[model samples]
Target chain A: MSRFLSVLLHGFWKDLPPFRLVLGLCPALAVTASANNGLGMGMSVTFVLIFSNLVISLLRNVIPNKVRIASYIVIIATLVVIVEMILQAYFFGLSQQLGIYIPLIVVNCIILGRAEAFASRNTPFLSAVDGLSIGLGFTMSLTVVGSIREMLGAGTWFGMSLASAEFEPFAFMIKAPGAFICLGLLLGLMNAFSHWRGENVIQK
Target chain B: MDLVLLAISAIFVNNILLAQYLGNCPFCGVSKKLSTSLGMGAAVIFVATLASIFTWLVYYYLLEPLGLKYMQTLVFILIIASLVQFVEIFLKKFSKPLYNALGIYLPLITTNCAVMGIALLNIKHEFGFWEMVVFSISSAAGFTLAIILFASIRERLFISHVPSFMKGTAIALVTAGIMSLSFMGFSGMVN
Candidate 1:
C-alpha cells in the first residue's frame, strides 16, 4: 500500500509536467483558458491515457519489437476515435469547443511518452495507477492554469461571472499570449516552491 | 478573391503554428537555430502541401464514394507515415545536403500536428480541390514564417539573462504567448 501511495505521489510532483518536465503543452495551453474547457479536455485525455495504458501493458509481450511504435500509434488512434465519437454524441458543445485538440491528442507526446516509458515496462495494475495519477496531475495543472486565465482574462470562472461589473478584464489572458504568460509564471512558482522545500529537507 | 483570402488567412490571420498551436513540438524542439528552422520549414511546406493533396483526394474520391469516411483518420495517418518514409528516401538520394540538414527531423514530420491539423481543417471547411491546395501551401508558409521567426528569437535568447526557473521552456512559453498576442492583431483583418 505504501508503495502504491508512493507511485501516485511521484506522479504529482516528480512527474508533474508543464511545471517540472514541460513535456506536453500543445493541448495544455490551447484548451485551458476556461475551467470547463480544461476539465473537459483533461477528462477526455484521462480516458485515452487509461485505456491505452491498459491495452499496451497487456500487449507488451504479444507485440513484435520491430513495429512497436506503429502498433502503439494504431492503438492510441483507435481510442482517440472512440473518445471523439462519444464526446460528439453526448457533449456536443464541449466537443465543439475542444475542436482539433481532441483529435490532436493522437500525437500528444504525453500519452505516447507514458506508453513508451512507463506502461511498456510496468505491470498492468501499476500502469493503470500511473495513468490515473499522471492524468490527475495533468488535470490539476490544467485547472489551476485555467482558473487563473479565466479569473484574469474574462473575470469569470468556467464562464460564470466572478468580478464586479466595473472590473475590466485583461483580454490577453484569454488569448494565446495569456496562455504562455500563465504557464510560465506557474512554472516559475512551482520551481520556487520546490527549491524552498528542498532547502528545508537538506537542513533537516 | 477567396483564394487570396485563404492564402493570407493561412499565413497571417490563422497561422497553423501560432494561432492554432499546431506543430508545437517541432516549433519548440527544432527551433533552437534559424537556419535549421528554415530547413525544417521548407520541408514542412513541401510535405504538408503534398499531404493535403493526397489526403484530399483520398477523402473525396476513395473514402467518400466508398462510404469509408469513418476510416479517414486511420487512412490519413497511414498515408502520412508512408509519405514521410518516401520523402526521407527521396531526399537522401537526391539532396544529401538537405537530407543531412533535416537529419532525424524528417521522420518526425509524420507526427507534426500542423500537417494533420491542416488536412483535417481542409475537410472540416469542405474546401474545394484548388482551394485545398492553396490553403495547404499557404498554411505551410505560415508555419515556416512563425518557426523561423521563433528560431531567431530563441537564438537571441541564448545569450540573454533568464531567471533560473524560467531558463528553457518557461521562457519559450512566455515568448510564444507574446507572439500569440501579436498574431491576434491579424484576426479581424480576415473575417
Candidate 2:
C-alpha cells in the first residue's frame, strides 16, 4: 500500500512531468497560451496516459521484448486518435485551439516514458494509479503555467477577467518567448524551493 | 516566388523549434555541445525531409483515397518509426562515415515531434508535393539554425556563474526564451 501511495504521489512534485522529469515539453510549451487550453490539453493527455499505462501494464508479459517499443507506440497512437475524435466531436472550439498539439501527443515523451519505465515493470492497478497521478500532475502544471500566462497576458484567469479594466495586459506573456521564459523561471523557482528543503535538485 | 516566401516563413518566421514548440526534447537534451547539436541538426534535416515526403505520399495516395483519414496519427507514426529504422540500417551498410555522424540521432527522430509535426502541417496546409518538400527542408533548416545558435551560447554559459538551482535546464530554457524573443523579430519579414 505504501508503494502504491508513493508511486501515486511522486508525480505531483518529485517526478512532475514538465518541471522535474522534463518530458512531454512540446505540448507543455504549446497549447498553454490560455488556462482553458492548458487544462483541455492536459485532460486529453491524462486520458491517453491512464489507458495506455493500464493496457501496457496488462500486456507487459505478453509483448515481445524486441518489439515492445513499437507495440507501445501503436497503443499510444490509437488512444490519441480516440482523443482527437472525441475532442472534435464535443470540444470543437478547444480542439481547434489545441490544433496540431493534440495529435502530437502521440509523440509526447511522458506517456512513452511512463509506459517504458513504470508500467512495463509494474502491475495493472499500480500502473493505472501511476498514470492518473502523473497525468494529473502534468495537468496541474499546464494549468498553472497557463493561468500565469493568461492572467498576465490577457488580464484574465481561465477567461475570467480578474484585473481591473484599467489594467493593461503584458502581451509578451502569451507569445512564444513568454512560454519558454515563464516555464524556465518557474522551473528555477521549483528547484530553489526544493534546494531550500534539502532535496536533490533536478539536474537536467 | 511564393515558394521562396513560404520557405523563408518556415525557416525564420515560424521556426519549428523556437516558434512552433516542436522537437524541444532534442533541442534541450542534445544541445549541450556545439558538435552534437550540429549532428542532431543534420540528422533532423535529413530524416524530417524524408518523413515529410513519405507521409505526404501516404496521406494523399493511401489514406485520403481510402477514406481512412482518421487513421492519420497512427499511420504516420508507424511510417516514421519504420523509416528511421530503415535509414539507420541503410546508412550503416552504405555510408559508414555518414552513419557515424548521424547514427545516434536517428533513433531519436522517431519520437521527435518536429518531424511528425511538419508532416501533419504539410497535410493541414494542403501543400502540393514541391511545396511540401520546400517547406519541410526549410523547417528542418530552421530547427538546425536554432539549435546551432543555442549551443554556441550554451558553451559560453558553462564558464559563467549561474545560481545553483538554475544551473542546468532552467538556465537553458531561459536562454532559449530570450533566443525565441529574438526570432520573433523575423515574424514581420514574411507575411
Candidate 3:
C-alpha cells in the first residue's frame, strides 16, 4: 500500500519536474506568464503524458529495444498532434494562446524521459498512476509560478484583477528575465526548505 | 533588405534561447564553460542550418502535396534525429578533426527545441525558399550568438561567492534572467 502510494505521490516534491528534476522547462517558462496559461499548458502535457505512458507500457514487450526511442518519439508526437487538433477544434482560444509550445511539447524531456525511464519498465496501470502524479506535480508548480508572476506582473491572479486600480504592476515579472529569476528563486527556496528538514534534494 | 532585417530580428529581437525559451536545457547544461559552449554553439549552427532547410523542404514539397501536414511534428523530429545520426557517422568516417570537435554534441542536437522550433516557425510565417533559407541560417546564428555570450557571463560567475543553496542551477537561471533583460534592448531592431 505504501509503495503504491509512494509511486503516485513522489512527483509532488520528491521529483517535482521543474523544481527538482528540471525536465519540461520550456513550457514551464514560456507559458507561465499567467496562471490560466500555466494550467492550460500543464493539463495538455498531463493528457499527453498519461496516454503515452499507458500505450508505451502496454506495448513494452512487443516493441524491440533498439528502436524504442524512435517508437516513443512517434507515439508522443502523434499524441501531441491529437491534443493540438482537439484544442484547435474545441478550445480555439487556448490553441492560439499556446501556439508553438503545443507542438514543442513533443521534445519536452519529461514526456520522453518518463516514457523511457518509468513507463517502459512498469505495468500499464502503475505507469498511468506515475504519469498522473508527475503531471499533477508539473501542473501545481506551473500554476504556482504563474500565479505569482501574474500577480506581480499584471496586478492580477488568474486573469482576475487583484490589486486596486492605479497600482503599477511589476511588469518585469512576466518577461523572460522574470521567468528565469522567479523559477531560480523558487528552486533555491525548495532546496533550502528540504535541506532544513534534512531531506535529500536531487538537482537534475 | 528583407534578409538583413530578418537576420537582425532572429539574432536579437527573436533570439531563440532568450526570447522563445527553446534549447534552454542545453543552454544551461553546456554553458558553464566558455570553450564547451562555443563548441555546442558551432555544432548547433551546423545542424540547425542543415536540418531547418531539410525540414522546410520536406514540409513544403512532400507534406503539402500528400495532405500529411498534420503529421509534421513527428516527421520533422524523425528527420532531425536521422540527420544527426547520419552526420555523426559521416563525420567520424571522413573528417576526423571536425568530427572530434562535434562528435559528442551531435546526439544532443536531436532534442534541442530550437531546431524543431525554427523549422515550424519558418512554415508558420509562410516564408519563401530564399526567405526560409536566410531565416533558418540566421536564427541558428542567433542561437550561437546568445549561447556564446551566456558562456562568457557564466565564466565570470564562477569567481563570485554564490550562496550555498543557490549554487548551481538556481544561480545560473537567475543570471540568465539578467541576460534576458539585457537582450530586451534589441526588441525594436526588426520592427
Candidate 4:
C-alpha cells in the first residue's frame, strides 16, 4: 500500500531521526570500529526495536498511563535479552567483538525514542515498519562512519587491507576522538547535502 | 591484587570519560561551569556505584546460573532507569535543593554509558562480589575526576580565542584527545 511505501521511504531520507535529530550518538560512535561490527550491532538493535514496537503498539491502550514508561522499558529489555542470547550463541565472534555494546543498546536513545514517539500511538503493523525503516537508516549511518574510520585508520575495509604501508594511517581515526570528528563531519555533510537538495529544510 | 590495579588504572590510565569516552553526553553537555560539573560528577558517582553493585549481583547470582546471561543488558538497563526514577522521587520528597540540582540529570543518567559500562566490565573481568564494589567505586571516582578536570578546561576555553570551526564540540573533542594522550603516560605505571 502507499502508506507502507511512505513509511519505508521516510526512513531513508525524510524521517531519519539519527541523521536529522542526532538522538543516539553513544553506539553511533563507540562500537563503530569496523563495518561488520557496525552492521552486527545495527541488526541487533533493529531486532530489539521492531519487536518492542510491535509489543508496545499492541499493549498501548491496556497499559496504565502512570506506569507506561516503566512498562515500555521492561518490554524493550526483554526483547534485547532474546536477541542478545541468539547472537551470542550463533555469532560468537561478533558477540565478543561487540562486547559490552550489545548490552549498551538498552540505552540507545533511538530505540526508546521510537517506542515513546511512534509505536505508542500507532498500530502494530505500522509500528513494525517504522522500526525496520528507521533502524535501517541508523544502520546505514553506522556503516558509513565505520567504513570511513576503518579505511582511513587501518587502511582496511572490513579488515582487509585497502591501502599499503606507504600510507601512514591517521592513528587518531581509530581512537575515541576520531569518533567525534567523524560524526561531526558526517552531520555537517549530511546537512550540506540536504541543503543542496533544497527540498525540505529541517533546521541546522 | 587486581582490584588495586583496576583502581589505579581506572583513575589514571583508563578513565571512563577521558579515555574510554563513556558518559560523554553529559560530559560535553554539562561541563560549561565548574561547579555544575562537580555536582553532576558527584551524582554520577553515587548512582553509578550503586547501579554497578546491584547489576553485578543480578548478573552473577541470577542471570549467569540460569543461562540467561543475554538478558543481563536489558535487565541492567531497566534496573538503572527505575533506580534513577526512584532516586528522583526520593530526593524530591526529602530534599529540595538536592532534587533541583540533580533532577534534570537523573533521567539523562539512564543512558550514561559509564553506568552500563561498569556493569559490563564487572562481568567481563569476572570480578568477585567485593571486587565489583571496588571497581565500581574507583571507576566512579575516575569519572568524577575526568569530568571535573574537563569542566575546568571548558571554563578556560570560554575565555580563550578559539578558531571559527573548532568552537564547541570540535574543540572539546580535541581537548579530550590531548587528555587521552596524557593519560597514556600512566600506562607504564600499571605494567
- Give TM-scores for every candidate, taking all chains together and pairing residue i with residue i: 0.94, 0.99, 0.97, 0.88
Question: Each candidate's chain B TM-score?
Answer: 0.96, 0.99, 0.97, 0.94
Clash totals in order: 1, 0, 0, 0
Q: What is the number of residue pairs that collide in model 3? A: 0
For candidate 4, please provide the TM-score of chain A on its own: 0.95
Q: Model 1, A161-203: lDDT tens per residue?
A: 9999999999888887788778877776776676777732110
Q: Where is the poorest 10-residue window by lDDT in model 3 chain B?
A: B160-169
Please give, for residues A90-197, the per-residue lDDT of candidate 3 as tens digits: 999988989899999998989999999999999999999999989999999999999999999999997889999889998899989899999989998998898899
* Tens-digit lDDT track of model 3 for B89-184: 999999999999999998888888988888889889999988888888888888888888988988888888887788788888888898889999
What is the descending TM-score order? 2, 3, 1, 4
- lDDT tens per residue, model 1, B11-61: 999998878878888888889999889889988998999999999999999
Question: What TM-score, to 2 decimals, does candidate 1 have?
Answer: 0.94
Ranking the candidates on DockQ from highest down gives 2, 3, 1, 4
Docking level for model 3: medium
lDDT tens digits by residue: candidate 4, A1-204 = 999899777777786655564566677778787887888888888888889899999999999989888888788778877777898799999988887778777777788889899999999999999999988887887888889988888889988888977999887888776776677666556656765777555332
Candidate 2 structure lDDT = 0.95
* Candidate 4 lDDT, B1-191, residue by residue in tens: 57788789888887777666677767777888898888888888889988988888888789889998766777788789888989999999999999988887888888788888888888888888888888888888998888888889888998999644445665665676677667767879986
User: Which of 1 and 2 is ahead in DockQ?
Assistant: 2
- What is the model-wide C-alpha lDDT for candidate 1? 0.84
Q: A101 in model 3: Cα distance from truth in Å?
A: 0.4
* Interface RMSD, in order shown: 4.6, 0.7, 1.3, 3.4
- For model 1 the interface RMSD, in Å, equals 4.6
